[model samples]
Target: MYNQAMVIGKFYPPHAGHAHLVTTAAAQSGKVAVLVLGSRFESITVEERVKWLAAEFDDVDGVEIIGMRNDCPEDYHSDEIWKAQTELMRLALKSHGVTSIDAVFSSEEYGDRLAAVFGAEHVLVDPSRSAYPISGTLCREDLGASWPHIIAPARQEMATRIVVVGSESTGTTTLTKALTEHYRPRFPGIADVPEYGRQFTYEKFDTLRSVVPDAGIQDMVWTAEDFSVIGARQNEMENAAADVCPLVIADTDSLATTLWERYYLGEGSYGSYHAADVLPRRDLYLLTDHEGVAFEDDGWREGEHRRAEMTEWFKEALTAEGHSWILVTGDHDRRLKTAIETIDLIVAQRSGFTSPPWASRSSVARPALEGAAA
Candidate 1:
């Protein structure tokens, strides 16, 4: 086993090719050092990418992530980037008491990159299929297409990534992991949309409630606040796909937010919506009934019959908002199968696309380089 390995990349957005490098390194090296290239511009911040990768690879013991800031300006072109980066690796190796074990892994400019840092013995890896070289750039371009079929097959090699959000434990997390297994997909990029209710047990919940007219915060938490989070979250997920579909199969999303509005407020409170104000919208949205899954409160969820009201309200809400969504019932097994198929259907649409589909504008598009590109 390679005791120590180094992975270097800008990861402007970590796509499938990026995952292949890390997945291979984790398998080959006893420990992998990921030196992320830093940026001088104010666009996507370093902290955001670091956090996303951390969440994605939290379970891998072999991976050690580090960020290398680019202090030099764009005009300051020097072959020295290769030199300085290599020296950093050599120092890391020496400190670890590692003479050398396996090799350096990378996607872009692998020859000069590994040679500059590790030596001539650096092995070149083509993680993508021999014929098709899937790189970050390719994933970025394809994402705008929102093609699920081509994406689904490409992601088969990488670990499964899922974001579960909905009322109580409607198997959001359970189903995410289960699908990950049933699929045996690469999962270095999986993350659970933290039960936002729990995330703000003290802070955000209290803060929102203080201003919220209804103390029925428990019922509406998934909606009002979560919508803001979900939209922001999906935008981030766009950049993180690789070794996983750019698809973000949400457990619950704006549809639920609308239901929360209808349930807590009057029938007229729910309003029109769209995500990112773009076409070729979210791949899939799975809304579950409380019937299949029993509601258990860890002090987060509050409702007597969360079964039909929320589900019904959501159907109306989704239709009014003009988003393509499916309501899922039955036990976990049946619902899981539906979700899988639904995602497949969405992916298939991406394969054969004419013109981009029209989508309602949810909000203004923020500059991608602003804060988070995860």
Candidate 2:
């Protein structure tokens, strides 16, 4: 057992393989400092990487995850470049009062040299990739294919969220359900979050009926507080779905709630808009057009006459917010096809990541630096 051990990586997005390496180091050493090195060129920020890993290992004993910026160029053959990079690592550890590493844990070829620099013993773990058959490169190349390998926080962050919005009975629920079904075969855990606003409406109407015995949805008044509750619940459900699934199809989201509050309360409402302001990042907004689709009352909808006007409001709001959205028009089949194609394009585009400067060289053999390069 070593007194102190060190693990270094780029952890561009810490995956299962990276977790395995850190746990192995923690098991063998009294304490392990996992240094996440980031460069200006990478898309995944160093602070985000640190947060994800820290959350992943929060319950584990004596494992410290830290992040530092290392802009030094990658060169396996240059001693000067190695020295520059190693100094950043030393400073990151020293800030936490960690000194004199007894072991250096890595799955890369640089383990020997990194250990020598620290005057620690080199301990290699899963150099063959037999333990977890995944890498950051594979994850970057195809997020959908490598979805299962990514850690929970990264999975939530990378998950593609498609929010279906529009006027009442505009097939928002129908489309969200269809999209969820469409992706479930490839992404087994894919699921759609039902419209929480509708549920809130049902409860409100139910409560009203109990008091008057003849009260209808029309009789129930909508307050700013009601929309606030709906907005908060909508965001909660969407985030919970994203935590476990690669793709989340939300029937409606907090942003949609903001518009609904404006529609009902004559605009300038702060309750639901405040909820929308803090919502997690949403990928796409799909507006189900009310032009061709007939609105069905379903005993709960009171906005059939306002369908066209509401649709226009949604389009305007989405445009003003600079959110990516598409109007789904035509019959159900055509609409489904258009939505699928658009989403496929988004997934493909997200998967194609810009390689860090260190990975641009093909001659340099790729080693598992956890998520970094040595």
Task: Give each model's whole-structure lDDT.
Answer: 0.51, 0.84
lDDT of 1: 0.51
lDDT of 2: 0.84
Q: TM-score of the candidate numbered 2?
A: 0.79
- Runs in model 1 deviating more than 4 A are 1-169, 180-191, 195-197, 205-245, 261-280, 348-374
Task: Report the Cα lDDT for residue 292, model 2.
Answer: 89
lDDT of 1 by residue, 1-374 (tens): 77677777655445445666787889877888776655655233456555556666778897877666644332114567556656655664556565664567754345444655455346566633332244443333444322221233233322222333355556666776565555445323343343332443556667777788576545344344444454444444443343244434434444454444455555654231343343123444565655768777667556646655655665665567675666667888897898788666554454322211221111212332111223
Span of 10 residues, lowest total lDDT, candidate 2: 361-370
